[model samples]
Target: MKKKTTIYDIAAKLGLTAATVSRALNNNTKISFNTRKLVLETALEMNYEQNKLALALKSGKSYNVGVIVPRIDSNFFSSVIRGIEEELYPKGYHVIICQTHNQENIENEKINSLVNVQVDGILMSISNANLEANKGLNKLLKNKKTPLVFFDRKKDIKGISSVTIDDFKGGYDATKHLLDQGCKRIAHLSNDRNFEIFRNRYLGYRQALLDNGIEFDESLVIETQSNVQDGRRAARLLLDMEAPPDAIFSSSDFAALGAIQEIKESGFNIPEDMCVVGFSNEPFTRFMELTTISTVDQFPLDMGRKAAQVFLEEVGHTEDVKTTQNIVLTPELIVRRSSSKK
Candidate 1:
């Protein structure tokens, strides 16, 4: 391999001080634009790789932000990650992403690892296990004061900020939409009840039924794992009941898709026999023509952007953490063929 070029080599070639080259590489505002451009060109020509770790150590500013997500395979969270990258990359920030696989131990370990890396800040969407009453992640994050921001799956930790959608309202709107379509005996296909967003959704569903003078039927509610298989199983169980639900409001689009599959397999016509509404307006929802009421465009992208903005503001001291902010964006309900009944 060719000898790797260093900043000193670039500085020597340009007859400028190494400090000027360093400042230019970092896009330091103090350096003149022309000089910065010239130094950057020289560094590139010499194949000089910028040493981020050395720069971080010298300034005590990593220019790196860590994000912990449950999983990246989901459309919702992935979009949020994209949003975060869009907001931070332009401002000279790098993101390190880690997944917890929804395990408490894994989540704890990831957070600790990020903290050890001296990251400037962390943005997290904790797992279901972390939300359990026995989990100690809330205490751990709070005690560290590590400039943590929670999005989507957040717990109420003092001094930490969060950006999320109004999950309760999303639940209410989904249930209400089904009811408006003449669904009296409707059931919910729920995810892990420990997650605050899911719990809030359940509450909203119950409240909407109560407001509409519909009896809250415990037998009609089916709890399932956060996936399509569980949704399919729950649909089968509900369909086998003596008085099957006329409609279903699922907390996840994956679950709703499963429910639709099972319903169709059972020879029940959709909308005419059973209507389905799903959350998280995922791309597949529109493609498949499923009627769903969803919250947040995708928590990952929006949350990521908002979380980075928060870190930027906090670092600049333009925004104070003393006044903790909980920003909840509104959800939209998309009417489609699946839930419509003439």
Candidate 2:
């Protein structure tokens, strides 16, 4: 086995003290520019590597952050990740992403694992699973104080910063748009209310209906997962009702796509017979062609950048508990062919 080159070996080769080599490698201003350049060139020639663990111990920073999400397959999450990377890459920090698969236990495990590895911070979007007795929150800083920030799906914990869209407004705008298009009977496909984001969306939907003199019907609302199959099933169930809905306001783009597919398969013309609006302005929402569903744009890329900014701000404070900051971005209701009455 070949032995690894160290600063001590580089120092010996240069006939200089180990401290001088270390200072030059760290780019300390005290070291002269010529000496620093010479040390760097010689170290590269010798294949020298700095011990990251020792540096982390000395500086109290891993220069690595953990980013947890429900899933990366979705366009929204992937775009958000791209934004985070764009902001943090130049800062000499890289992210380690973890997917919770909408499971609370899995989310907790990921937090513990990240903490064990001594990550500098953690950014997450909580899972769909109910967190009545969540252990992940407790396990976050048992060993070390890690900066934590929430993006999109988040909780209202004191001293914890979060960046999210105005979900209530998104829901209200989507529902109100369908109403403006002369949709009398509107059905809502919602998700679990255990999450604040979903609950706010549902509330917005109901508020729009109530404000427009339409009675909010519980039967017209169905709680389903944010997936294509679930959306299709919910659409079918609504269609089978005694008085079928003329429009649908879904909280997920995938679900809205499923409902559109089901509506078309049942020989219905979109906007003519049934109008539809979905959340998350996903990539497919624009190029849906036949469906081209109307959706609320949450600006996920900006959300990720804002979340990274919050993490940076939180990490800057030297105290164990940092001050909280809540940044709520606006949601844009995009008008598309799927919901246009013309």
Q: What's the lDDT for all of these models?
A: 0.81, 0.89
| Model 1 lDDT tens row, 1-342 | 788898789888999898888889888889999999898778767878767778777878888888889898888888888898899886668899999888777887887787777788888888854444424465555556467788988888667788988999989988898899899999998888778999988999999999999999988889987688988999999999999999998888888888988999999988889988888877787776544333223344666678778767666663443456688877777777778785
Model number with the top lDDT: 2
| Model 2 bad stretches (over 4 Å) | 1-51, 141-144
| Per-prediction TM-score | 0.85, 0.85
Poorest lDDT segment (10 consecutive residues) of candidate 2: 136-145
lDDT of 1: 0.81
Clashes (backbone N, CA, C under 3 Å), per candidate, total: 5, 0
Residue 190 in candidate 1, Cα distance off native in Å: 1.3
Which pairs clash in model 1?
A: 79-301, 80-300, 80-301, 81-300, 84-304
Candidate 1 Cα misplacement greater than 4 A, ranges: 1-49, 129-139, 142-145, 289-300, 318-322
Worst 10-residue lDDT window for candidate 1 reads: 290-299
